[model samples]
Target: MSWTRKDLLAMRELEAGEIVLLVDTAASLQEIATRDIKKVPALRGKTVVNLFYESSTRTRTSFEIAGKWLSADVINFSASGSSTSKGESFVDTAKNIAAMSPDVVVVRHSSAGAAALLARELPCSIVNAGDGAHEHPTQALLDLLTIREKKGHFEGLHVAIVGDIAHSRVARSNIHGMRKLGMTVTVAGPPTLIPPFVQELGAKVSYRLEDAIGDVDVIMMLRLQQERMTAGLIPSVREYSRYWGLTLDKLARHARPDVLIMHPGPVNRGVELSPEVADGPYSVILDQVSRGVAVRMGVLLLLAGRKGGDGG
Candidate 1:
């Protein structure tokens, strides 16, 4: 089968067949990550550029590690110390990077559609690490892999994604992926934190998280972006937790001992979810981070294709 290059901006871009291929490939790559010699030859000689217009350590470092594991040459760009600090536009910076002829560009920027904008102007495939509150597709993919490894299939499962729904790109992407995989998704948070029209996205919406917690198959919590907190979108962490936090009491109300827990990392601990819940048997949070490396490798190799063999 010919490997078609996939630009992973959102779960909407993934078809069933493609999801299967990517997941299967990622599972195989996971085995490689377990080996003493962690590197793989699949993307030897490729050039992978990590272009970030925002600050991050986990996502950026994960992408860089993924690229290096596949034997790709990697360049990590930061906005603060780079030419972007000199007032260069994103397009200009992308064009300049493209001049070096990278096999793929993994971009994360503060603007919602920055990666898509870069995709339109660049020759290489684009992997949207994140783009504002718009989407974080790979996070969704890795989450899917984590759930699949545990629950086997998403169909017939009830998933409750609690916390900041309005501003979480992870939640947005997970909603799409879960629905596509035939899971029932319910988003729960304060009225202000959830988009009023969230049901239009095929998810059941609830103002009180308790309403959606019962007998659910998965509990997905999102990080509370401090920027959102400072914006006063959420009144205060104490108030936010009272209304939306996944406390021990909340988990008990769900009553499903097997209800798998998940979170995209840099967890706020006592804020979004309790420390006990995060470290509980139900939590696959750490696995999500580990799987991130493999999922990114799968995406990078797929996008790079045979062109990666040239080390461009």
Candidate 2:
């Protein structure tokens, strides 16, 4: 694939072949992170600006490191420090930034269609880091890469995504990407927490944690999204954990002995997952984080690099 798109907005819009290309490109570039120099001249003069309207840890840092490793000039802009907090509209601020000529603008906003709007308005390539509860494409890409590394393939692999599905951008993106890649996805959460018509996304819905964990190939527990909560989704964190949390006991009794445990972190230590299960042998949480950087690097290289440049 020659990579014709100017933006990488959501997994829902990507072809199955495009997804495979991204994973392959990331795997091909993983060696750079291990090398002594750890630098690539791939995007030597390209500039990438990370525009985040919300708070972040992993996603923000990963994009910065990825751009720096690829030798792109990387800048970080957050709402607190930027004109956004001063009542500047997103489009106006973004236009001001674009006038400076960045090669790519990676955005994370609290509005669902922020990235799509930016893609429509900006001349630079847009990468959706996250947009409200809509999608986190790079997170899904790294998750698929990790799963492929562990399971050898995506077809027929049962991935049970547990917790906070209604507000989880990771779950939304993963549902689309995994189904497109031929995996069976089951979203498990409290009835109030699971959105209506989610099954239309080609994923099965489950209300029982016990049922969701049973004999699955992957058990991905999501952090309880407290920040995104507007209504009472659950009575309390303790109650949600009692029903849905992945404990050592739960895994031992119901989950497969070889089932991979994954969490996109800033983990709620005892709420969504227990300490033992999170640090246990089958856990690939750390692998997911490491693969995140590689995945972002591949995305930046693909979207920011000139389509005319050396068969990109």
Candidate 3:
């Protein structure tokens, strides 16, 4: 299938073949990182703008490096230092950026429909780095790539995603992407943290951490969002850790010997996973980070490298 979409706004909106194509593209580009001169001319004259309304270390930097590696001019914009801090509306700021004529605008915003709004308003190709509790498509793609690299396939694999389901965009994107590609997903967390209608999104909800991890091929632990930890979502971090946090003992006793451990990071250390488990042999957390660049590079090439692809 040829690439047709101008914007990647959400995982739920993509077809299974589209997802597979993205993962395969990223897989082919992974070897570029090992070259003596880590650069490619696929996007030589393209311009990618990282328009971020929220603070990010991994996603923002990953896009910058990805564009640079593909020989595209990458410009990063932060809301804090830009006109957004001086009462400039999101639309106004975006319009100003659009006038400069970028090939791709990778955006991360605090609003759920921010990327969609940009797709509607801007002529440039849009990539959603993340939107408020909505989706992070590239993160899910890199995760799929990492899984394929490690486990060799996606069909019929069971993945247990544990922690902060209600506040996780990564979980939402992963659930949609994985289910479309024939993987089973079980989202596990406290009842307060697990959204009521996750099953409607094609995921099995489990309250017990042990029950969720047992017999699964992959265990993806999510970071507990401390900012979103309001009045009653969780009683205490200590209590949550004791019951829900993944430990070496939990892995040894409950999870399968060949089960892969993963996390979309800025890991909370002892809250979502123990230090030992995060650094353990079964953990592919670092692989996910490296795959992030390759995934972003693939996205840039597809969306910006098209013929007659000129943006406002």
Q: Report the error of model 2 at residue 277, Å.
A: 0.8
* Residues 145-189, model 2: lDDT tens digits: 999999999898999999989989999999999999999999998
Q: What local lDDT score does residue 143 receive in model 3, on the 0 to 100 scale?
A: 99
User: For model 3, how does the per-residue alpha-carbon lDDT over 1-312 read when each residue is reduced to its tens digit?
Assistant: 878999999999999999999999999999999999999888887889999988999999999999999999999999854445688889899999999999899999888988999999999999999998999999999999999999999999999999999989999999999999999999999999899889999999999999999999999999987765566788788889999999999999999999999999999999989999999999999999999999999999889966565331
Candidates 1 and 2: which is better by TM-score? 2
Q: What C-alpha root-mean-square deviation, in Å, does candidate 3 show against the real structure?
A: 2.1
Model 1 misplaced stretches (Cα beyond 4 Å): 1-3, 81-85, 306-312
Better of 2 and 3 by lDDT: 3
| Whole-model lDDT per candidate | 0.84, 0.91, 0.93
Residues 212-299 of candidate 1 have per-residue lDDT tens digits of 7786888898888777768778778888877777877778865488888899989998888889889987889999999999999988
Alpha carbon RMSD to native, model 2: 1.8
* Best-fitting candidate, scored by lDDT: 3
Q: What is the C-alpha RMSD of each candidate to the true structure, in Å?
A: 2.2, 1.8, 2.1
TM-score order, best first, reads: 3, 2, 1
lDDT of 3 at 105: 98
Report the lDDT of model 3 for residue 229.
Answer: 57
In model 3, residue pairs whose N, Cα or C atoms come closer than 3 Å (at least 3 residues apart or on different chains), thus clashing, are: none
